[model samples]
Target: MNRSLVRHWIALLLLPLLAACGTTPSSQHYLLTAPEAPLPQGMTPSIGVGPITVPEYLNRDSLVKRIDSNSLAISSTERWAEPLEDGILRVVALNLAGLLQTENVRLYPWHPKRAPDYGVKLRLVEMDSNAERVVLVAEWFVYRVADDSTVARRLSKQSRPLPATTQNGNEVAAAYSELLYALSQEVAASIAEAQGNPAAVSAPST
Candidate 1:
C-alpha cells in the first residue's frame, strides 16, 4: 500500500476514538422547589398529602422544555419521569408544611400509626406552559379521616405571566415559585376553614 493511503486509513480509524474520548455523559438533575406561604392562625393540624395526580399531557418525558412557533424541544440533558413526579410531591409537601401552623406535615408513603385528622388530596388537571403564561388547574379535597368524609373540596386555578426575554434557571424558578405559592395558600386556607376558622373562608380570594 502507498504510504499516503496508509496514513489516511490510520487517521480515519483514530477519528471515532478521538470523538468518543471528548463525549462525556451529563450528570445533571432537574429539580424545582416550592415557595412558602403565610401560616394560618391557631392551628396545628397534622396533614397528610396524598399522591399528586398529574394529567396525561403533563406526564411527558421532558419536565422542562421550550415550545416555539416552529417546534417543541426538551431543555434538560436527561428526561426522568419518576424523579419529576417525586420532586413535585416533595415541593408541595414542603410548601404546605411551611405555610400551616401544624405540629407536623408528612408526605405519604408513610403508614400513619393512626389516621391523620385531615388529609389533603390533589389532582393536577392542567399544567400548560406557554410563552405568555403558565396556567395550572388543580382540584383539592380536605377529608376528615375519622369519619372518612370530605370536609371541603375546591378547584383552584392559577395563571402567571412568564418573563418575555428570560429563558434560564432564575426565570423558570420564579415562575414555579409564584404558582406553588398560590397553590399552597389555597390549600392552607381550606384546611383552616375545615378547622372552623371563619377568617380563612376568604383567605384564598387573592
Candidate 2:
C-alpha cells in the first residue's frame, strides 16, 4: 500500500480505541441544602441577605478539600450544581426564614424600590474539609440600610466532625449546609437585636 493508504488504514483501526479511551467517568454533582421546615407565619420586616463573597480560589464549580493547612485539593469528579456563593446565599435565606419565623426573606440584588430593613453581609474566609472534619469561617455584618448604620458585626467560625467512614461529597455538602444553618442562626440573633428598634425596615430578597 502507498504511505497515505497505510496511514489511513491505521487511523481507521485506532478509531474505536480512541473512542473508548475518550469515555470519562460521570462527575458527581452536589448541592447545599438546609433542613426542610415551614416559613414563619408571623409578619416581619423584609430581610435581604446578600453580597456574600467567596475567595477567588473557591469560586470554581468543583468541590474543594484541604490537604494540609497550606495545601488544598480540588475534586475533578465532584462538583457543585450551582455557584458556591449562590448556594450559600440560598441556604442562609432558607435558614433565616425558618429561624426568624418570617417569610420576608430575600437574597441579594434587591429591587431598586425594595429596600430591606436589614441587610446581611458575609465573606467566606475559609471553607474546606479533610478526612476528619469540615470547617467554615466567615466575617459577617448586619446593617440598617435606612440609617446606613451597621447594627452588628461578627467573625463566625464553625467546624463539624465528619464520620470516620465518610467517603463522598454528599456528606461534605450536608456538613456545609448544617454549618450555614448555624451561621444564619447567629445572624438572626443580630437581627433580633436590630428588630427591637422602632424603625420599620424590611429585608431584600434576590
Candidate 3:
C-alpha cells in the first residue's frame, strides 16, 4: 500500500478508540445533608457554629472510602455538592438547633452584640467510610465569650452501618451525613452538662 494510504488507514482505526476514551461517565453529585429535627417544646437556639476543619484528604470534591486497612478508594463519578467541611458545619449547626429546641443557631462572624450565648468549634479527625460503615471522629468545644473561656469540650467518635439494601457511593455519602447528626447529639449533651455545671467540661490531659 502507498505510505499516504497506510497513514489514512491508521488514522481511521484510531478514531473510534479515541471517541470511546473520551466518553466519560456523568458525575453524580451527593450532599452530606440532614433534615432539621423539630424544635423542642420551649427551648430556643443560643449557639454559634464556627471554625470546623477536616483532613486534607477529605477536603476534596470527591468522596473517599477506606477499602482496606491501609488503602482508600476515591470515587470519580460520585462527587460532593459542596466542600465536605462546609457540609459538616451546616449539618452540625442545624442538628444542634433542633436538639436544643431553639432557633438561636448562627454561623461565625455574627456581630458581637447579636452573637449566641455559646460558640461551637469543631475539628474533624476521621470522617470516612467503607462499604460496611461510616465513621466520624471529632474534637468539639463550646466557648463562652462573656467569660472568655471554654465551657465545654469533648472528643466524640461515632459509626453508622451502611444498610445492606443501600447501594454504593450514594448510600455511603448518606451514611456519613447521618454520622454527623449522631455526633451532634453527643456535642449537645456535653453542652447541656457544662451549662448545668461548667466544671463538668472535660479538661486537657496532663
Cα lDDT listed for each candidate: 0.68, 0.86, 0.78
Residue-level lDDT of model 3, residues 56-136, one tens digit each, is 888899888897888888888888999887888888887777677666788886788886778899998898887678888
Ranked candidates (lDDT, high to low): 2, 3, 1
lDDT of 2 by residue, 1-206 (tens): 79999999999999999998799778999999978666477657678999889998899999999989889899999999999999999998888787777788878888868888888999999998999999999999999877769988989999999999865899999999989988887888788767784332223233
Q: RMSD of each candidate?
A: 4.7, 4.7, 6.3
Candidate 1 lDDT (Cα, whole model)?
A: 0.68
lDDT for predicted candidate 2 compared with the true structure: 0.86
TM-score of predicted structure 1: 0.74
Best-fitting candidate, scored by TM-score? 2
Tens-place lDDT per residue, model 1, 123-154, is: 88766566677777889888887777987888
**Model 1 lDDT-worst window of ten:** 197-206
Q: Clash totals for all models, in order?
A: 0, 14, 4
Quick one: ranking by TM-score, best first?
A: 2, 3, 1
- How many clashes does the backbone of model 1 have? 0
